[model samples]
Target chain A: MNWNGIAAIWRFEMARFFRSIIQSIVSPVLSTSLYFVVFGAAIGSRIPEVEGVSYGAFIVPGLIMLTVLQQAIQNAGFGIYFPKFIGTIFEVLSAPLSAFEIVIGYVGAAAVKALLIGCIILGTSFFFVDITIQHPVWMIAFLLLTSISFALLGFILGIWARNFEQLNLVPLLVVTPLVFLGGSFYSITMLPPIWQTISMFNPVLYLVSGFRWSFFGMADVPVAASLAAILLFTALCLGVVWWMFRTGYRLKS
Target chain B: MSAIVQVNGLNKTYDGGFEALKNVSLDIREGEILALLGPNGAGKTTLISTICGITQPTSGAITVGGHDVIDDWRAARKLIGLVPQEINLEPFELVANTVRFSRGLFDRQRNDAFVDQVLKDLSLFEKKDNRIAELSGGMKRRVLIAKALAHEPRVLFLDEPTAGVDVELRRDMWALVERLRADGVTIILTTHYIEEAEAIADRVGVIRGGELLLVEDKARLMSRLGQKELRIELRDGVEALPDALAGFDLTLSDDKRSLLYTYKTGEERTGITRLLSAIQDAGLTLADLQTRESSLEDIFVGLVHTEEGEPS
Candidate 1:
């Protein structure tokens, strides 16, 4: 199993994360606070309660989802890409560890980093709004699944990308817009029928909906459908990652 | 000694249709140093990379300590350590942590004492806490060695270990290689410096045009293929060779003050006495006589030149 090898990679990555601990923790926290001020305080005052939950509390899960997705992608993407860029990836490739173990080490560390940021934003939310988790276990499960799935996607992105522009392309141009349009700051039910129908194709919408369901116990879509969406998304990403390693995609020539 | 590393009929062709290695086969003995000598694009690095499992071979089998490098890579890789030619490192990581990280990568149990010893052996103990970016080029090379040794592999591959280091560090590195050999570790180093091989390798392998031209015991190869030159200096300069010395194959110096006579070292009769007698009969007063042996570099150049069908 090469448990020690996996631990070594995990620890090495975590050390890099801790080296920039202040920036890692503060950026998302500050953004989450700003979103609350703009959307929760000022806008919520003019709007009525959203599906029996306060508007401020309504956006908490979406905010966590938004940040977790971004952090997971960026952390895992940069984590693997930097090694490739500096040529230190040769060490990892030549080691006794297998592809599965290597992926676990890198993706696990990145998932943990995103999970930490998600938790911090959750804590920061307590100060801004009154919140309750009707399904705490489900919330944790959703958070873990989303972090791991997106981290896997990020790992694939890292391997597939050849330059900095390509590395940042999907996360910035594709993911950020999807998150904003996928109802991170509002409910999809508030959109028109056609837009709501189109939102069904946005993968991030399911992540936010399932996560919000764990908090308020009221979701725009059925919880089972959202759960299926994330599970299917995770499986798809896993398949791509498996193919990348098996074929030695960008990792080996 | 029994072979600890065996490569059989290995071939590698890159996707771009570049044939980097051509049916290369080799056996590295345990506790002995083998030097691979070649010029650029001669497949030395590709061969090492394949055996270490960094580059996948197009075809052929390789085993380290009786374990297949492909199917049983976990076990085989655990027994090998590699120091690549490039100095790739985490600039922000501490020196000590980099070594420890490599040890763990090999799945070795955490042995702080051993890691510390490796650092001390490399003279990097004082800089253990410093980031890699803070070190000089020579010091970073030391860190690379430290990391490779941290795992304590039975077989080590040093690919151009002394390529860009200073003279003092190169000497120190050579000394360290000898110490490692004393501990019974098998070392294979590829280098452009023929002198490095002559000084340290038990056997020298010459590779040219993606093929291993020869691998033989250092002393035996030197004696078998090496040539010696005898130079006869005369008190007076002559513009042309004398008729009496015409029977011998000799070259006159451009200034015509000395004559050069070449002979094989392995020959039963060099005919030096006959040549000298003839030179004296030619009425040339001998001012000085000297003999010089060809170096490994000379032999290497001759071999490469012969392979290319050039005049040597």
Candidate 2:
């Protein structure tokens, strides 16, 4: 993709973000704070620290990740969705743009929004908990990887959803439960061995673990393995998107 | 003239077995504006969508500038631009930026000059910096056209370009369309506005029930299918027509102010003199007369209504 084209897309994407400041900034911050209040202050007070970190500090990454994940999915999905909703996708599709150009233009812009919101949540996080980055580079890398990954997943959702309500099903029903069950607030090591095995089955556990490992320098799963799992998931979603473009799936037919 | 677009045996059947276009084939000549006309659900939009590659054809093939629309959409789409009937644009972006970004989508190097020219041509330069939401409905409609023309496509498709536009804006857009045609853009417009087709189309094609009913030059189609109506105004108003005029095929006005005589198309002698003598013999006074040629609207109505009468 041309840098100029990418810049054009990025600029347009940023404009859309600022266009709805209420959704982009206010909603995420308010919702994450509530999660902090409920899951952190209320629930974490009773549970002991799983890995020498304060329960409030331990749950911070999970709350941020929840906002980041949902924001990323919604940004990417809605970036594509509203065009089809109002019938402007025709302009995009009919342009001389290749499938690669479209994916990068749309998915890359979505990742930028996700990353910005993640950073905002991080900055606000310091207000509530005395948080320090154990490995700033690892945290940034995991934040980008997970946001881009979920954004691509959301891009797929945008294409497949034909109606408004149908758009909410996957994120609200499936992804949220997976994020909650994933060891964001407490370590899987703190769970019973049976449920710990089940937690391992949740792909988001690997992402939350991988991201949490960045902040605290420890994770319920091996940090390297978790990193590898997140990378694999990202690659798989990218592959699905590439296949969709090649076959014109849900696009032409 | 070489064919700019060739559609052969195109068939599109939706999932529930509703065929939208059935084995439709045609060659659209280069540099001519072809108007596709039909009633609602007549496959006009489907045909244009298929040609533009917005909707996939279930069977058969399409080529633009000799490039297959499916196999080589890049080249094919580069040659075509479509302005859909709906006023769909990025609600937040400035008009200039939206048009500029559309050009960039084609990976065209920043051609701000071309973008500016399109804006000026569409009379959108004043609204260039305005967000799309700030524009009036007519301005928004013009923005859609400007976006479509940003790349200077060779074959432009306008699907109901003036569906809801006010008369003044519609005429302005029509004038702009004429200017584009003069610049050698081959336009294919689908419209329910039969008057628009009459006023602007070089050739017109009618489609109904998933089938192309006819395609002909504007003048030839009008002359060939065109009927003549002899509407005679009475110099003296009467309650009813004379019994001597019973042999003629006609309709009497309910108010008895006029008599309508239907005649063969383009007939040199309408048998008017004999009819007048008959009226005179019936002791009716002379009346002024007027004649009207069949409008494209009349022929179109005749075409679709006859199909309704056909046995299924």
- Model 1 chain B: weakest 10-residue lDDT segment is B303-312
**Docking quality class, candidate 2:** acceptable
RMSD of each: 1.2, 3.3
Model 1 lDDT tens row, B1-312: 899999999999999999998999999999999999999889999999999888999999999999999999999999999999999999999999999999999999889999999999999999999999999999999999999899999999999999988999999999999999999999999999999999999999999878998999999999988999999999999999999998999999998999999898999999899998998888889999999998899889988888897655
- The TM-score of predicted model 2 comes to 0.89
Superposed model 1: Cα runs more than 4 Å off: B310-312
lDDT tens per residue, model 2, B85-204: 888888888889898877766556788889998999888998899999899999998898887887778999999999988999989988988998899889999999899999999999
Whole-model alpha-carbon lDDT for candidate 2: 0.85
Q: Which candidate should be chosen as best, given lDDT against the real structure?
A: 1
Tens digits of per-residue lDDT for model 2, A1-253: 4455556665677788997989889888888788778777788688787678888889888887888889889998888888878788887777667777788888898988989999988888787778888989999999999889999999989988898787888999999999989977678887899999999899989888878888888887888888899889889988998898777777765
| Candidate 2 Cα misplacement greater than 4 A, ranges | A1-9, A26-60, A123-137, A239-253, B234-244, B267-285, B309-312
